[model samples]
Target chain A: MTSVADTLDVLDQAGKWRAAGKGVALATVIVTWGSSPRPVGSRLAIDDGGNMVGSVSGGCIEGAVVKEALAAISDGKPRLLDFGVTDEQAWDVGLACGGKVQVFVEKVE
Target chain B: MKLDTLHALATARTARQPVVRATRLADGAEALIYADRTEGALSTDGAIVAAARRALADGRSTTVEIAGGMVFLHTQTPASRLIVVGAVHIAQALAPMASMLEFDVTVIDPRRSFASDARFPAVRVLQDWPDDGLNAVGVDAATAVVTLTHDPKLDDPALEVALRSEAFYVGSLGSKRTHAKRRERLLAAGITDAQFARIQGPVGLSIGAKSPAEIAVSILAQIIEVRARRAEALQAAA
Candidate 1:
């Protein structure tokens, strides 16, 4: 489980990125099924430059999520993404734990 | 997400108050909802505020469909606290173990020699009577009180305060006969039998714990079991 300090750090980083005029997006693990690495409510904050804090999926699909988060930042729209081990590219990203995860990515306005 | 609202959320977290942050998915508008009041864009709407309040009461973060869009309510509750009312050997072991479990631990003892910082390095040590120490610390629902002194003068006063408060766990260290006598004293002191039943005498899981460290492990294990079971029940109800 993530400590309160960790959660605060993610929020603090998002605030700092926004203050610096950097486009920011927040990705949260809204739902998890089976043996997903991170629990529901885990967060990852990403800035325009792809700098990020925290983790929504313990490094398994973070790269894909970050790519989507950057798109959300540009469009100022929220996107809900679903990923599972059944996907053909799951083995390439290391999400072979036979679990499904849904992440919500939104611009931190 | 206004800077003022963010500041208020940080302040509430520092003060250990239950607070919820509701973020609207459509426009990214945010609100800070406290037990008494709310601050920000979503504060004025009764429906959103009520939903946030329900999330806070559930002590979990969740998404709810509102009028215009879906809002994610991130509920943050205060950290769990464990007050060990006796700076004894078991407490020395128990305090650190409890800290590892993410509990804010405080060791209390009236004896200056025992309650010294040297004994409880990196732990909050209170050199005062049990009742006074507990009062200063302030017991609440997220708190657990354990008396290890085995002395009536020390353990009884602490139990009196703990039994009356909303502490989730109240434990006392003693054998069955000792607990029997302690029960009589508590009954005479106006503690009802129903309330007295809350005290876990011989305080620790019966793991045949022989050493102080082993006993501390057992006690911490029991506390975790109780907390997990309570959370499971809450989840089931929710």
Candidate 2:
């Protein structure tokens, strides 16, 4: 688990980005399964326009995750996004593994 | 009086570098400072330093009474960051493990040939001189600076800058004798013995590492050990 100080650092930096009029959303990987790209507690930050500062996966499902994160940012709501490599939608989303991953998307103020 | 004492207590607990909160024995301002840095308080500098040092050494969180007030020091290591001043072979192996260890790794070197996406795909590689590169990354208490160039023209200037920064660990890849000679050069350039003491010569622990990757592992291992030992010491003090 990351320390409060570290999390605060990210929040503080994100705040600066937001102050600069950038759209920033915080995406946290809450769960992962076999062969998942990122472990739980991994974070990927996305700006309002969909520019990514970090990665939630090993580049496996970032495109889909970013879309979800962007939607959450626009709606000012949180989203729980799940993707499994075995699902047909996973193929549509370009995931190549049987492992499942869960991401929580929250827009940063 | 309560607020004053609480501030003192917090300062006392934080002198060693752990994150601590001091609740006044009576009632007053809540003084929060990292265990390693407790300043702007009266009559508690020594205590804060002692407490922080002890808490950091222990690597655990604790609640205690300092100057008759309750204070808590959390001896958790901040995410370690590695600032490599050169993009050499050793850095390639070192960067990934450091990432695995949760270190925010940044490689800085002016040589475009050495600092390229192909060489450091997973790490942030900067094609700038060490001085400018380090400034961009913003060295702090949680950062470690390693000079791997072995060239005085490059390593010396880099060491000169890093020694003055807040980076907790500053090591150079060289033998002790080499460091001794390097010290002479630094002294000529106005770096004092006290400042020289800040550098870790012979870089990593005496692990007899031969290959670049092995040496990189040894270096990071030493960094982690130093971090852990600092936590332990702080815990004991608390």
Candidate 3:
């Protein structure tokens, strides 16, 4: 379950990283279509060192979202990313069939 | 996401206040919305604010297409509360389990020695008597109250308060005969038949549980079942 404590833990980790002067980015699942393992508001916090916590599409799309988050941290530009079997990358990591998600990555300043 | 916004959200969660994070899809511009106030440029936008409030009411997150762009409303309400009205051995097992499942667990007992930080390290241990403790915790629609202290002195008062309030699950630990006696006593004390029926005496799914830990598992499973059914009913009504 995506409980409140999980959200607090993720955001607190991001805050701590930012306070420690580590560049941090936050990735949130803004939309989910057919059989998303995680819900729409699920989040992942990524630090500049490539350290990550939490999940967006459980596992299939996380590696891709983390890459976007790291890039967002470097450039300070937000990105809205999409992944599923239909999209390019096809996840080939396998969302397998429909399970599409729209993830928004933003730098935590 | 701004640090101050993140900090404010942490503060709201600590305070158990329902809050919504509104993000504009076109730009990732953000705002935090509380029932009484709003925290960013979108504060002036009635449509998004209303959407955020609706999100809070249903305890679900969603995306809304308002003019200019799309807005995502991520609603975060306090974790559901579980008040275990005893610091008995079963509670020692149950409290941590409930906490692991993200319930804000509270162990209430008048015995300070029993309801101590040593016993319930992860959960709040309230040393107040049953009635006082339940009132202090404040039962709501998301709250679950269980009486694990078999003694009527400890369990009945808590059961009375739980039944009168909106707490979604009211369970008392006892045998079938014991529960029959309990029903008689509560009826004498003026609890309605319908209200009396809400008490799940022999409280647990009939899993043939023998040990305290096993019983705790059964109770937790039953609570989860009740919560899911209630959520489905509420969604259907909506």
Give the lowest summed-lDDT range of ten residues in model 3 chain A: A1-10
Better of 1 and 2 by lDDT: 1
Give the per-residue lDDT of model 3 (tens digit) for B140-233: 9889999998889999999999999999999999999999999998889889999999998889999999888998899999999999999888
User: What lDDT does the true structure give each of the candidates?
Assistant: 0.85, 0.70, 0.87
lDDT of 3 by residue, A1-109 (tens): 2334444478888988998999999998888889888888888999999998888875887887888898999998899988877877755656765788888899997
Docking class of 2: incorrect
Per-residue CA lDDT of candidate 1, range B31-81, in tens? 887888777776347887787788777777888887778787878788789
Give the TM-scores of the predictions, in the order they appear.
0.79, 0.50, 0.93
CA displacement after TM-score superposition, residue B194 of candidate 2 (Å): 1.1
In angstroms and one decimal each, the interface RMSD of every candidate reads 5.7, 14.1, 5.1
The sequence of per-residue lDDT tens digits that candidate 1 reaches over residues A4-82 is 3434467678878888999988888877789999877788989999999989987999999999999998898888788
Q: Write the per-residue lDDT of candidate 2 for residues B16-70, one digit (tens) a residue.
A: 2345443232222234455345543333556755765665555444445676564
- When sorted by lDDT, best at the front, the candidate numbers are 3, 1, 2
Report the number of the highest-TM-score candidate. 3
In each prediction, how many residue pairs overlap at the backbone (N, C-alpha, C within less than 3 A)?
0, 31, 0
Q: How close is candidate 3 to the true structure, as a TM-score?
A: 0.93
Ranked by DockQ, top first: 3, 1, 2
Give residue A82's error in model 1 in angstroms: 3.0
Which candidate tops DockQ? 3
**Steric clash pairs (candidate 3):** none
lDDT (Cα) of model 1:
0.85
